[model samples]
Target chain A: MKARVHVMLKTGVLDPQGEAVRHALGAMGFDKVEGVRQGKVIDLELAEGTTEAEVAEMCEKLLANTVIERYEIDLD
Target chain B: MKARVHVMLKTGVLDPQGEAVRHALGAMGFDKVEGVRQGKVIDLELAEGTTEAEVAEMCEKLLANTVIERYEIDLD
Candidate 1:
């Protein structure tokens, strides 16, 4: 089974990396680019019997920093 | 318009960060986790008239490294 997780910064959290990307785009002459928020995607290949709950636990325990980030998971 | 771009390392490319994460998961006892791949997602808020081609151009120009990375663009 495969699971895809998207982890993004929570609203109001400071994202220096995102800001750096925005600045880089600006320097590259992408002047119309208004805002840029960067996040992460993790693709996990798990054993067949692994449950969604276990995958969520993985996000809570290590994949995501809940204090500053939120994650969404999709299983296939 | 909102565009979501997912950038991932091409297969056969070495991903030190993903390996680090896999190791970390193993250390935390996620023994059933087989493989992990890490990627980036960029959320872009563009002017209403921005075209998908333009956004893809952004990825090719600066958002993703085409040599080792491939990006998928979704506009909404």
Candidate 2:
């Protein structure tokens, strides 16, 4: 089994990293660019039988900083 | 219209950021945690009529570094 979880900054959070990208893109003539938010992806090759709820809980508990970020998980 | 593109390193690529997260999670007492990869998300608020293919082109041309990262876009 494999799982990939993506964690990112929540709306209303200030993202300096994203801002820097936007600035660079704008300078490169990408006027269509708006905002950028950074995130993380975790890949887990798990032993069979791991539950999706358990993985979601991991996102809530340790993988994501809920104070400023939201997360989504893809399981296979 | 709005578009959100999520970009991250492709599989088999070296991800030091993800490695650092795994190590941190392990130190924090998570035995199940495995690999971690960092990525970015860009959010755009566009005046209607932006095509998905065009957005994907922007992703390839500016938002993502194809040498390492792959991207997915969401339209709304």
Candidate 3:
């Protein structure tokens, strides 16, 4: 089985990196780009039968900085 | 309109950050974790009617390091 976790900065938190990207885009003449929010994706190959519960635990414990980020999980 | 770009390392390339996260997960007792790959997500708020082609161009020109990364774009 596999699990994909998408971790993103929570709304209302400042994202300097994202701001930088937006600025870069504007400078490159991609002026139509209004905002950019950067995030991370963690792709995990799990042992058979590994549950979503355990993956969520991983997100909470290590994969995401829950104070400033929130995560979504997709299983396959 | 909005678009999401997912950028990932080419399979043959090395990913030290992914390796570091894998090590941390193992140390934290996620022994069932067989592999871990890390990537980035860029969420873009685009002007209405922004085409996928423009977003793809952005990926090639700025959003991703084309020599070492490949990107997938989703528009909505």
TM-score of the second chain in each model?
0.95, 0.91, 0.96
lDDT of each: 0.91, 0.76, 0.94
Task: lDDT for model 1, please.
Answer: 0.91
Write the residue-wise lDDT of candidate 2 on A1-76 in tens digits: 7888877788888888778877876787667666666666677665577788878877787878888889888899
Clashing pairs in 3: none
TM-score per model over all chains: 0.93, 0.73, 0.97
Model 3 Cα lDDT, one tens digit per residue, A1-76: 9998999999999999999999999999998999999999988989999999999999999999999999999999
- lDDT (10s digit) by residue, model 1, range A12-74: 998888888889888987777788899999999888998889889999999999999999999
**DockQ, cand. 1:** 0.80
Binned by DockQ into CAPRI classes (incorrect, acceptable, medium, high), candidate 3 is high
Ranking by DockQ: 3, 1, 2
lDDT of 3 by residue, B1-76 (tens): 9999999999989988888888999999999898888999999999998999999999999989999999999999
Residue A21 of model 1 has an lDDT of 84
Regions more than 4 Å wrong, model 3: none
For model 1, the docking class works out as high
Show model 1 residue runs off by greater than 4 Å: none
Worst 10 residues of 1 chain A by lDDT: A25-34
Query: Model 2: how far is B64 from its true place, Å?
Result: 1.7
